[model samples]
Target: MNKQMTRAFATGLLAAAIALLIYLYFSPTQDLSVEKMKQKLEKDDYVVVNATTYHQQVNELARLQKEISAMNKVKPTIKQKETKKQTTSKQKTNSYHLVISSGTTSAEIGQKLEEAGIIHSREQFDEYLKDHHYATKIQIGEYDIQQSFTFEEIAKVITKQK
Candidate 1:
């Protein structure tokens, strides 16, 4: 009787597992169509900008890029005039925005940092990354780096290591 009961329990458990698998196999997946996506976005209160707005934004971005390029090319000549008493003023710190996507290498990141005046030499940065094993551990995302950060801090930030 015990042997028969054990056999029955095993059969029932196996049947239940098979039923679960069948049910899962035939279940409907989430709708991934464009219309459904639009609906979801609307439901989440996301605004979809019109073509005119998009075009205006693009133009503004182009203008900003041109201004940045012009600034980079021009070297300002400053005439220092010493006042009676120098006021202690806080200097503004510069920050660079970096976007790293899949397949982005350390060399590219280093070059961008160098161009942004965040890093002195791209080659040295690359070498540091390679030596520290951070080249392969870099996370793919956007990073805001202050000009005061050292190479170690930059590497830690890019690697999401805090």
Candidate 2:
């Protein structure tokens, strides 16, 4: 009777292992792709946050975001001061020469222009270049630009054929 019982238990274990293998082979797990994730984001109303951040303090993060919004509502506006030093600096930035390095990207050149105060925003300069398809046509050389020059004028000067 003991031998018979032992044989039955061994057969049962083998059958269970085979069943598990069949199930796994029939139903494979899936990985989420970028397109699928984008679709889910667009279709669903779920609020997503960093996994580790949410696990730590989701409530605190929400509160901080609210406080930031409140602060932005009361943000101070800039009022230009007409000091002598300010006037001198403004005059210096008016007519300046900028050197464009070889193989530099459009964003980098835009940033340089913004830093020199020849343009208001780097993003605006970049957009102007892209809209006019001059991003790839910028040449490496010295460019003389004034602070009052429009982005279009700057782009033209930078991309002109030598």
Candidate achieving the largest TM-score = 1
* TM-score computed on alpha carbons, candidate 2: 0.42
The TM-score of candidate 1 is 0.44
Give the range where candidate 2 is weakest over 10 consecutive residues by summed lDDT: 75-84
What are the lDDT scores of the predictions, listed in order?
Answer: 0.87, 0.81
Candidate 1 residue-wise lDDT, 6-83, digit = tens: 999999999999999999999998869977888889999997777999999999999999998887666332212222
Q: Any residue pairs clashing in model 1, and if so which? A: none
Against the true structure, what is each candidate's TM-score? 0.44, 0.42
Error of 1 at 32 (Å): 99
lDDT of 2 by residue, 104-146 (tens): 8899988887887777789978988898899999999998887
